[model samples]
Target: MRTSHPLWPAPFPILIPEPRGYDMVAKALTIAGSDSGGGAGIQADLKAFSAMGVYGASVVTAVTAQNTKAVTAIHPIPDDIVAAQIKTVLDDIQIDVVKIGMLGTPSLIAAVADALAGYAGPVVLDPVMVAKSGDTLLADSAIDALKSILFARATLLTPNLPEALKLVGEGSTQAQAKALLDLGVGAVLMKGGHADGEICTDLFVSRTGTQDFSALRVNTRNTHGTGCSYSSAIAAGLARGMALSDAVGHAHTWLHQAILHADELHVGQGHGPVHHFHALWK
Candidate 1:
């Protein structure tokens, strides 16, 4: 009955019982595309996860030729390959949350939806439709596929003003959030970066209630991966057992410092990345 792995040395003389998962750091899986710039997509997701003290795993759905300037070209991974990556990771890793980013095409979206069929956990979906440098990332045709296949399964859908408009047309932030919730997502985070004002507000809307988190918006060109990192931070907090409102608040507070410190970094000439490790660096 003692069928431990040969490489394992069992803990003999166990005197005290340990709490379940006490030794394990929270783990999250980011199923997204690759950003050659390292500012967004899987790169940003991993960095954000680490910054939040969460272990990160990744399944890349596409590879993009990109930098701070623009996303030049995108090469989507085959649906089967994407599915395999999801299966391989989910079969082994004890992931606590699933953070999904830019999934290029409809086929890849379907594949991800299928791969995550039975997974019952928190899913934070950041609708990465456009890059920082005004390059389109998601296909217009795939929007329907994403909503039908993944929205219902998502615990949080973080969308900026423009992306929310595309999904729900022109409306107030609250109206947009309600429209997205009507699409069957569990909750919606209406990001206000695109809106005009010194005071930035992110509205969190769900069936139960709504909460608005406001922060001093830092003015910086180094906002390349803000959305990606924000969503990952939320996922990290959720994995650590925080409520959704608390997780959103945590991300909002952390991101201000990151953006405030970004000017210290000299990356590409274009829109650079946020300082995901700002807390440790400063």
Candidate 2:
């Protein structure tokens, strides 16, 4: 028997808290190619996004039937379909950041630019021109289209040493970075992974000033998707509302860790992928 008090009834009833609404999750979109090998491109981008605790969406511009050894064949998605995919995602979801990679053709690049014309979210453009296996991913004709149509719209342009050289046409690293920054992109991250040096230095150039990030070169053949992982990690940081410089710094650290532990994973023959899940699983 329960005693009744001034603040209580004879029969006590248990009270439960009402369920709360779900919190809004940060979302990121990857406009890139599909790598069947699960190393680079959309797969790597999505993995990096997830590792950074962001929801990932993808719009595939092309599909490559390849492994760690080489890219055997590539089928570029139609421009209309690529545009439709981007539009559908944008129509329903509020994207926090967009990461672009591996537009195989000029039409596809133009289509991607047009689709993302009015998007206000931060965009990180990874001008992917060649595969790790030395396979041509983007045609020579598409380079001009990429610069003209998309450069102005990008919040950040991430190009490797080779791609930077191609964009600026034969110059020192600083000169190439300056030329790339002049293309109207808000910022440029010139990657030096391809350069032969004891320390790999990445240059982040903007209108304000330039920042240099250097790390010891991790000597390993398993560095296939370093570029993709770096750009997507930056996009992930941006989606989490980090400042541009902070985001780049975090991404640089993440990429270095991934590369440092790359040899742990055994995936395929030839140039394997960096361990994108190193932080999460380790």
Per model, state how many residue pairs clash. 0, 0
Candidates' lDDT values, in order?
Answer: 0.86, 0.86
Compute the lDDT for candidate 1: 0.86
Please state the error at residue 167 of candidate 2 in Å: 0.7
Measured with C-alpha atoms, the lDDT of residue 123 in candidate 2 is 96
Q: After superposition on all CA atoms, how large is the RMSD of candidate 2?
A: 13.5
* Residues 153-191, model 1: lDDT tens digits: 999999999999888898889888988999999999999
Q: What is the lDDT of residue 13 in candidate 1?
A: 16
